[model samples]
Target: MTLSTQERTGPGDQAATGVVAIEATRLEKSFGNAAVLRGLDMKVRDGEVVAIFGANGAGKTTLLRILATLTRPDHGTVSIYGNDLAREAERARLSLGAVLHSPMLYGDMTVEENLKFFGRMFRVPGLSARVLEIADRMGLTPRLDQRVRELSHGYRKRAALARALLHRPRVLLLDEAETGLDEPARQVLDSVIAEHRAAGHAVVMTTHSVERGIAASDRVLVLAGGRFALDEPSSSVTLTDVTRFYIEPEPGDA
Candidate 1:
C-alpha cells in the first residue's frame, strides 16, 4: 500500500502508530543456486521497533540488506515512506539509515570527518551541531578526531552508528548492531532506539542477542528457511520460546 502525500512528508507524532514506514512484499533473493529469502513479507509501522532473531545463515542479514537498499532483491518490491525502492531508489534512500556488518566508514578518515561527510550527504540541518551531538550521544566525542582504522572494533562500531543516526532517518535498519558494543555503548544504543521510536520512526534490526533484542523491541520475528517461522509481539514471547523456535526446524526447513 502506498502512502498519501501528507503521510509522505516525514515522520509525524508518536501517536501515528498505524503508519507503515517500511514495507516489503513477496521478497525473494537467491545467490547462485541457493535461495536466501523466499517470498518474505514484512511491514514495520511508525513508532515501532522490530527485532529479527534467527540462526546463522537464516537470511537475516540478507533481509536487512534488501531493506537498507544495499542489495537488490531478485524479485520483490520494497517501499520506504511511500517511495518504491526500484522506481525511486534515490528518494527511498533519503528516508533510510542503515548500519550493516561492515562499518561502511573510510578507514583513513577521522570519526568526525566520517560523520560530517554523511551529514552533508543527508543535508542535515546544523551539520556541526548535529555531528557533535551524535558524537556525544554515541560516546565518540573524544575519538571523533581519531582515524577509523586507529580505533578498536567497539569505537568503530560507535562511529558507524553515529553516522547512521546523524540523518535522523525515518526508517532505521541495523544488522547485528550490538555485536561490538560495550555496556555503555549498548545503553546508548537502547536510548537511541527509544528516541527514534518516540519520534514516530521505524526500526528493523537483526540480532543474535535474544533477550536484549526482545527487551528493546515492540515485536520479535524469527526467520527460518528463508521465511518467518515465528512472528509475535515481544510481550507475548519469552527468551526460551524464541530459542526453541530457532532450534526446531519447521516442516520443510531442511
Candidate 2:
C-alpha cells in the first residue's frame, strides 16, 4: 500500500508526486565468465531515497557503477532526469553526483583543491564560496588543506562526499557510503540526505547493513543473483525479515 502524505516518513512528500528521476531497464553486466548483473531493473523518483542491500559480490557496487555512468551495462538503458545516458551522457552527468567505493578523489590534492577542481569541471558559479559551504557541511573545514592521502579513511570518504555535493546535482548515488563513517559523521550524513530530499532530489545508496539501509531509505531492495529478490517500502519490513530473505540461498546455490 502506498503511504499517504501523513503516513509517509523520511521526507517523501515530493517523492509522492511521481516524478521519475532515475530509470534503468534490463541492465546486465559481467566480468570474464561470471555474470554479475542479470537483467536488473530499477526506478527512483525525486525526493526519494532507495537503499539496495546485498551480500558482498551480489553486484551491488557493479550496479551502482553502471548507474553512475562509471561503467556501462552489457545491455541496458539508463536515463537520468530525462537525459539518455548513452546519447546524452555529458548532459545526463550534469544531474548526477556519485560517491563510489573508491572515493574518486585525487589522493595528492588537498580536500579543498579536490572540491574546487570538480566544481570547475561542473562550472559551478561562486566556486570559492561553494567549496567552503560544502566543506563546512561535511565537517571538512578543518581539513580543507589536508591532502586526501594524508587524511584518515573516514575523512577521505567525507571529502569524496563533499566533492559529490559541490554541484548540487539532482541525483546522488552512494555506494557503501556509510562504511567508514563514525557516529557523528553518520549523523551529518543523515542531515545531508534530509536536505537533499527536501530539495526534491533523488538518492540511491547501496549497503550491506540492513539496519542502516532501511533506516535511511523510503524503499528497501534486496539484490541477489543480479535481481531484486525483495522490493518493499522500508516501513513494511523489519530487520528480521530482511535478514531472513537475505540469507536464503539463491535458486542454484549449492
Candidate 3:
C-alpha cells in the first residue's frame, strides 16, 4: 500500500512469464462532459517500445500524463513495473522517465545545475559523475553552464531527457518527444531509446509523425474516438496504412 512497503516487496515479486513494465486496465478520463479516455486497456512488456498515434484531441497526451502520474484517471487502475500506481505512487514514480512537451526545468538554472538538482531529487548514486555522463550522451556537455532559458528548444529537450534518465528509470513515457528536434538530436533520441530497450526497459511514446512512430516502435497503437482503433506489430504495418486510417473514418463510423 505505502511506497516503502511496495518497494520492500520489490518488483521481483510480480515478475512471471514476461516482465510487464506498464499495465492499465479499464482506464477512463473526462473533462466535464467531454470524455477523453474511454475504457482503455494496455500492457507494455519489458524491452518493448510502443508508439501511440492519434489526431489532436484523441487523448494521446492525456494517456501519457496519466502514466507519468501527473493526472489521475477517473476510473480504472494502472501499474508501473508491477507496482500499483494508485496505491504505490511513489514507488511507481521511481520506475518512470517522462519527456513531455514542457521540459519541466527551472529556466534560470544552468543546465548542469538543473541536472544536479534532479539527480539529487532522484537520489542518483554518483551524482556528479552521472550528470557528466548524461550531459555528454545528450550532447549537452558543451552547454552545461548555460542557463536553461538561453538554450534552444532542442537542447532544452535534451536536458529534460537527461534529467528523466538520471536515475535510470525502467519505464519511459515520451509525449511528442521529437517535436522540434533536428536530425542529429532526433538521432540521439533514437539511440537513447535503443539503449533503453537493450537494457530491458520499456518505452511508451506518443507521436504524430507516422514515419518516426513506425521507425521507433516495436508495436503501434492508433488511438481514435478515445479508444484504440488499431493495435499491431510495427513490422506488419506501413506508413500508408497509418495515413489512410487517419485520413478516413473507422469502418463503423456513422
Clashing residue pairs, backbone N/CA/C < 3 A, model 3: none
Q: Model 3: per-residue lDDT, tens digit, 158-229?
A: 999998999999999999999899999999999999888778788899998889888888877887676777
Tens digit of per-residue lDDT, candidate 2, span 1-254: 22222233343566767578888888888876677788878878899998888776778888888888889889989899888888888998989999888788999999989999999999999999999999999999999998999999889989989988999899999988888899898888888888887788899998878898898889887777778777778888788766665654353431
96-188: candidate 1 lDDT, tens digit per residue: 899899899999999999899989998899999999998988988899889999999999889989989888888889899989888988888
Deviation from native of the Cα of residue 151 in model 1, angstroms: 0.8
Error of 2 at 203 (Å): 0.5
Error in Å for residue 118 of model 2: 1.0
54 Cα displacement, candidate 1 (Å): 0.8
Model 1 has an lDDT value of: 0.83
TM match of model 3 to true structure: 0.90
Model 3 CA deviation exceeding 4 Å by range: 1-17, 247-254
Error of 1 at 155 (Å): 0.9
The residue pairs found clashing in candidate 1 are none
